[model samples]
Target: MPSLFSWLRRLYSLDTLDTRFTSSASASAQTAADTRPPAAKDARANSIAQGARAPLWRTPEFFVYYLFFITMVPLMFKTVVDASNENNPVYAKYSHLLSPGWVPGRLMDNSDAQYASFHDNIPYLVALLVAHPLLRRVYNLFSNRSAQSSTSSAAAAFDAQLEQRMQFDFGFGLVFLTAIHGLSALKILFIFNINYRIAKNLPRSYVPIATWVFNICTLFANELCHGYPLEPIAMALSPGSGTPGDQGTLLVQWARTLDGFGGLMPRWEVLFKVTLLRLISFNMDYYWSLDYPSASPIKKKQLDPAALSERDRVKIPAEPAAFNMRNYVAYLLYSPLYLAGPIVTFNDYVSQQRYTPLSITRTRTILYGIRFFLTLLCMELILHYIYAVAISKSSPDWSIFTPGQLSMLAFFNLHIIWLKLLIPWRFFRLWALVDGIDPPENMVRCMSNNYSAFAFWRGWHRSFNRWIVRYIYVPLGGGGGGHRPANGKPTGSPPPSSGLGAKLQKICNFLLVFTFVALWHDIDLRLLMWGWLVTLFVLPEVLATMAFPAKRWSSRPTAYRVLCGVGSVGNILMMMVANLVGFALGLDGLNDLLASLTGSYLGLAYLISCCVVLFVGVQVMFEIREGELRAGINLKC
Candidate 1:
């Protein structure tokens, strides 16, 4: 109907609309195509990350081994129980009459009481076992969620962060395994009197030889689960062969050649020997396995060039990677302090490639020497006295003392031992607090804090505590940098950096730290009760700290000086009471006495005495505080 020019214009407008639609659709399609590669690549990276993070035993091998061991545990327990019963005819004859209705004869008499104890402890064991797998799944889910919400860089950073934790977890697994094994053995020896000599002469000829072979095989299977070699040669060449004196030494050296190599040959050989030596040393020293090295997921990796320019870059020193065998040997031989120690980090140890005195000074070398002498003196004199007067005397049917007297003595002895230990700790703290020490900065900071007054308490006893923290806390989701709301606050409570937040944070920190402090002593009902009571008493001081921050007081001369003195006295009393309570609970007779004493007028008197002591404690704190204040004022004037 239109002229030719108008027709051409109409055609152009329609074409423009069509072109716009086509271009928009093409753009959308192209965007989707471009995004697909990253999504796929991200997924691939995640899979790789997960693969790297996965525990060593992914297949059913660990399960199969666990089941096999579980079955054998019962059998081994039975053997020991029977053996114990046979040895103790007195118990064997009368135990039936004394048996409570709840305990079956088989359950009471079973050689595998320790192993079966785990069976009875099914709830706890199951909880621990299930917790790890469940936590892993939960972690994975959270990781995925975080990745989805975050940029690729953030996601990558998270993965790397998790990787460091994984390394700690892996290392701690070795410690945990060692603890379980050592503790089990110790329990058997202490409770059932299972003689180690029995193992040495376990077989009585051909049949015994077969039994030994079977036991050896079982041991091999157990070691295999832990990624250790079960080769007989490895055992023979291990340091401090269970045999006594020079005969054992010669045998160890001779067995070294069985590997058809020298003592320091094959890397696996060294690892195996070291593992053996560590185990042997743990047994010899009656110390826990806090130093064992295990396979780690956080292998050394090249840093990305892009991340180098970041402001928060942690510049770790460039140190040699080789182990200082000389220092390692020295640490083993002379330093009983490391029997429970600084829990030397691999990084710290490797940094000192030479035996230089400066390196030693940096490592608080002077303190090490002081600790050695002090520890030896305490072990010889103080511990010996406690052992003779308390532990030995407190045993059943003591000729020199009544059970009550012995119990009281035992309680006081524990206090003495704690005091003795404190002396060395004070020295260690002084060394740590002094400037320019090469010890970890965190260790120094922890030493400086008044709350951590107990030497064997968490940060101060770095070796054992670090092992426990790594093995237990991190895996349990408590230790990692994952934010825990400030103390006394609810789990999901808003952080307390704001005005209201500070109070909540303080409360949470107090409760959490105290609870941890209590649990760290041991896993027993008595320990828990003791911990709870101590926390109640200690909470006020912690709250005070929160309410009046140390820094704030430091600025106010009069207040600061007074607070310092009070703090010192308060901390000492709190520690002493905590130690005494812990000691009383540990004593078999003392626990009974306390339980019996709880319902009388005398009990009321005892309670009053405790309260009065606590009051005097306050006075002591005031005096100390006032003294510090006077000193500060004089200095200022």
Candidate 2:
């Protein structure tokens, strides 16, 4: 029993062995190999990388343990399927489809409003993807290149053509936005111009503050205005109300006409949330570029060459001319990433235009496509057989389920949520890959594989994680220390050294980041609570790792490994609870779940069994990671 307890703590400590995500693209740029580190990197390639060989099947103990886990998979499915069938007997007739001839399948619930929108728009996305390359080709053939110097060398001229190609692509994106959004595109353009002006016209010292205020306000204003209907404003400004004769008439007509044009994509704010992030990226990158000592006027050398590593290229500031209204507009409205992004920084996006990353090869992209389709098929299977989403939506009596069944219901629902997001992000990213742009890969690990909270967040929506780190966390002093401005005062007021103060600062930074994340997702109180809950959940693990720094006890291998295992069990439990509250079940549902588990003998037995199962599962997770390390791959998630 003591050994088992120690093993649990060891699981947690083992997780802390991985390095934190790198600070910024600039920090990466100083290194040659990384402009932006690939979401996953070769373990052999990075100095911090660690590798070990620990094959599960080689050890009898693990082989039995893993076999049990494998066997439980089908049982877990049946548990949820039984509960779903019991809850919705009407849908039980569709059970025949599961066995054979599963065609033209039915969704027990199509109530997921967000995914419904994406599903409806698949044809449109497909059309856009199909047309993108053709559009680029047309632009290359017909777009004037007379502006380039005819006497330039082959490399220089080729570089200029690529530069011009990006210009065409960016402009084309604006047109794409307009087609889908109609007059609402003007609203996006208006916000873009406002943000661009702030970045350009404000003093370098003042840009970050002004940009944050304006963009954050825009986000709130957008929600408050409900995408800012023009007709209502026009009605308020009508001549009969107060404004003189024809003065408001023409304005009213324009506003009404603009309102009419919004019919194509009335809910423009959905995409604008993502667009808002790009706005911030542009201004912030522009702000930092000004501080770059090497920044100079537009020059031919500013066009990044094919030879530059992605890390250096991403950090290298584009010339002053590149920040113009046209390019700024183009970058913000870029089609593939505009709706939902594996966000690329402004500098990174511009750099890719100069030369595609070496990683975006034909074989790799095709492989990615195959992976995406397989995952999509997996989602389809889950949707058809599990009906977790439908079951969750229906809100059946929770008390009826055995604790294990209830747990699986929540677990499978989270899986559905993960798959829904993963499929769409992969789809868009694959589209970008086809177009020779490599946005960061978003979901890097299975939801079940994660044991650490930090690792979970790092791997989940990974590009967004990087975005927050660079633009938000680094600026706030979560990096090595706070970034110093020209005034030489640290912005984040980071602790002078590591101790209680540093940990408090780190917690505060996390709170701020998660708060922004919640707000960015939506202006909902539930999400805000979720964010706070996640931070709270992360606290114990953070404190635990600090209290028992792995190195301090590394010499006592038996005791240390056991200690980490214990911590890992607790961390995994907390992570699952937090995620359930945030994504699968709400706070009330979680409360009910806990109450039920502790209320009765059966529930208590089930809960204990789950913990036992989780302990073994976490060990397997550790070994899987170890296997990856042996293979010279480390995702650092």
Candidate 3:
């Protein structure tokens, strides 16, 4: 059987070669250095090339993803609209399910409940799963094809090489991760018996079952659900009744409690402080700390006073820049305007600060502000409508809903939360475009004059992405080092300065970028998990960058490359675990479980420990940034 298979394979290879050889030999060959060309053939070739390079919107993947998302989004929207309707059985069932925990006269009135129903939309979850793969593939193909067409007739010699090199572990790993998520989704639907398309009559005992189903479903919903577990669960756990009557009673009791305690402000203030602390902690851990520089070069004893005085410091140093914590923080907080940054770097920030006048850029800034405001307005309108519809219906008996109907209702609520969460991305982009301006040098270097234009599509709503690139990528020797180019030359010249041992430097970059990203988003175990998971790409890139400072890692053995690829797959799994944990934590039931476990441990010791870790992280970041700035200043002099 093996011999027969080999013979067939050989025959297939011969046939392929014959076809290719005949086609090429019969085709008209042009002179190697022709001054003139055949117009008709040249036009045809140009047409073919242009077709291949067409915008992503024209690609099959893009269209498929778009169509799928569009369909799903509307379907989910309809589900929410139906559930919020006063006459809907689902609304009545929801009210009944919540009445047991409700204080009469405190819940939303039927009219308000009607508005809230608009929140139910499972389509967003569907869209996330279906759209991501298509978009990623399209982007990968577009990048590869563009690279191939840019080279000379020697393109064939390097085409295979470029293709192989461009095969990033990140993209392939994500696909597998997505597949697992898809399977999880199917499991959710089957186990929960969620009829996501319908708003239906259901009984009260079904509430718990529904809540469980929704929570499970939400876990797999992706960014669309904004990490909310499920609606039924939320309603069951809500502070007030499902109807206005319950809400009024709850409010009165709350007022009485406040009167007994002197006022609500004291407790409210505590809540506010906790929220602020959490936000700071979350951002620090996920966004800033992971990439916090190792230490100041002056502290590390790596900086040389003699080298600082050299005139031709531009002669790329042998060592890459060392990780400095101060540089990271400075990059993070340099521009007060970008404090809520679309994350930028010390170098990019400096360039923009020096070149773009605040007064001159006011018009562009105003427009961006307007855009952001509009997006906020739209989100508010949607949320308001949803709240009004879903929270005001007449209460139903616990006996009214089946387990299946209850589950569907819970899933419906999860959809509402997701829609609410996504509102931030739109406004964030607007804010970045308005507030973040690129310098003139950046315009020339980035191939665009409009700072907002560059940021509009890239970092405007993606401050964390910018943060990763600047604080993590640049320091580990990714971004064009801290200096501007001379006479508009390409920045890809051989390195002249190296500070961190090449291997260590790369690893530092990966760890910092992924770690910071994980911890910056939330101060939870899930974010920590995510940080570790994302480190997959960071670790390899760091090693690869160090191994071949001049991009020579491509020549490394295939076995080594395969190992890196496998490691990346493991990273993706870790990320998925992190994301799942995040979703679980967002659920009230999960929070209750955790609180039960840790509430007793919220002692002075725990508080002190947290403070100490925070202090060390911040101190490290500041020291690194200060060292970098000093080094930069000296170099400039």
Candidate 4:
């Protein structure tokens, strides 16, 4: 077994295998210029990996940190537990699950329905995860045997066979989802088919507009109609089985029978939201593929499918045969990431089928698995001891807890939200890793470690952030003139004439990005407000960066660090308020929280103490990043 210290090192290290894995289509363009000999990259990697700085325990400054950590952690736990146990009705019901030994707190199953679904169906999920690869291997063994005698070059034959096998895999995935969703799966299929047809047949220019409109419409339709149930339609058509042996009655009866399996994944719409992202990815990729300059007839004949370049793999559109319905279906419904994605783009997903990344090694995967189980256990313990989620749902009397404890309620609740998402994303990603596909790691840093709103979003739901950047942010010209002309001339619009115009354009882009993100999460007004509030909170950091560019202060390290510390404290406070409003509490609860915090002198003192503690935490976060830098890793977020 690895030493405990080694495992701790792995846990703290930022350059885990998945962190280095690229899932964005935008990043795939770098693969085109990746001709630097492997040894050069390896040497640089080795130099960076040569040694780490002294451990935290050895650092003198960290003694203060250790003191703060040791004091604060237990106090926060006690605060959360004491607050939870204080006549909260949810705790009273689950008191039997409470333990009084070391951590005296009530235990209960998670109250969040989405997470509970995953928790409840672990046995089935595990069975599917186990059986999927075994079945795939069996299919591949026979496929390779049958394809060995094909009249093609060895590499070309292998490539052809892989695509053929993918068709089988994709078909199987559709069937599997259909089995679980019953007739409800047809709604997904119908939407997929429409998008597929649009990509294949529509003019390249129109594809983007059509794709966006149709998919966005489907979002509303899914919400309004609830995954477009077919059972009602079937019942109407059959109407008590008018003619027992009639073909129409038989067909309608089959539809009703198929609907029975809806219980397996009852709210299929939950999964459809994720599927919508893949749909956009596929259509947009297809649109861009159409725009790529095609090869000459001579080059086309000479082109060996297996000898394709990185540019060919990513940027250049594949042959019509490669983008067919079969592959499209497989890419959309690939079982592991089909539910909750550390979303991989269509191009990236297809490319990985042929060339699995070096990052998905057995050791790395095992370590990832260990990390996942550990996180799950941590989440379970938190749920058991701290009834924060239950407390939040039960509408407790907030007056019972002191200001510090009230703060912990929101604080721990956000952490629970973080873990709820992190555990599931990591679980599915682990499954993908075991199957030799590397999806992006969703949570690269702990929630408490972040001070910058922008950095927090980038690290949290990181794959989705990447997806937003690639599909939504960049295309809308959000980040520094996305897809601008190579010569720096503006294309579709006149240049922003003034500095204010440029800033406004950027802000508008952010609003749109967050709006879409909010709607994507769910079509709720509260989330929309959350999105806008996030945009509002990020502006201070933006202005601060403008005022204090790092290059301008390189000579005055002390002043720069001090300025950053102050700014981070403010950011932390703003972020907490924003998150509390969005996730843990609505505006009313937040208003009540703010009123309670500033309601009296003692409450005000507690608030100041909270800020001081957050400031210290931010310093540790900064040190953690510095440590990463010293060890040759720079996770810029």
Identify the leading candidate in terms of TM-score. 4
Stretches of model 3 off by over 4 angstroms after superposition:
1-71, 83-339, 344-354, 357-367, 385-461, 474-512, 533-580, 583-637
Cα error of candidate 2 at position 496, Å: 3.0
Tens-digit lDDT string for candidate 1 (31-98): 21221222232343234334322232334634554555466435433433332242433333333322
User: What are the per-residue Cα lDDT tens digits for candidate 3 across 1-637?
Assistant: 9998965443332111111111111122221111122122344333433433123345564456456556644654565545555565555444542322123334432232222232232244235434543554576577767764454555343343323322422344224323433223233224223321111223433432443344324333433333223333445555564575554444444543433432211222111211222222222222222222445332354443222211111111211221123222233322222212333333333223222322124443444345445544554444433432243223333123332222233343433333333333333333333333321111111111111111221322343444445333653455554222223333223233564554455455556655654544444566676456445434543454345453354466444434443443333233333333443233343333334333445433443443333333323332333332322211010
lDDT of each: 0.35, 0.72, 0.34, 0.73
TM-score, per-candidate, Cα-based: 0.35, 0.85, 0.32, 0.86
Query: Which runs of model 2 end up more than 4 angstroms from their true locations?
Result: 1-57, 86-108, 144-151, 238-258, 294-304, 484-494
* Top candidate by lDDT: 4
lDDT of 2: 0.72
What is the alpha-carbon lDDT for the whole of candidate 4?
0.73
lDDT of 2 by residue, 569-591 (tens): 88888877777777766787788
Question: Which is the better candidate, 1 or 2, if ranked by TM-score?
Answer: 2
Deviation (Å) of 419 in candidate 2: 1.2
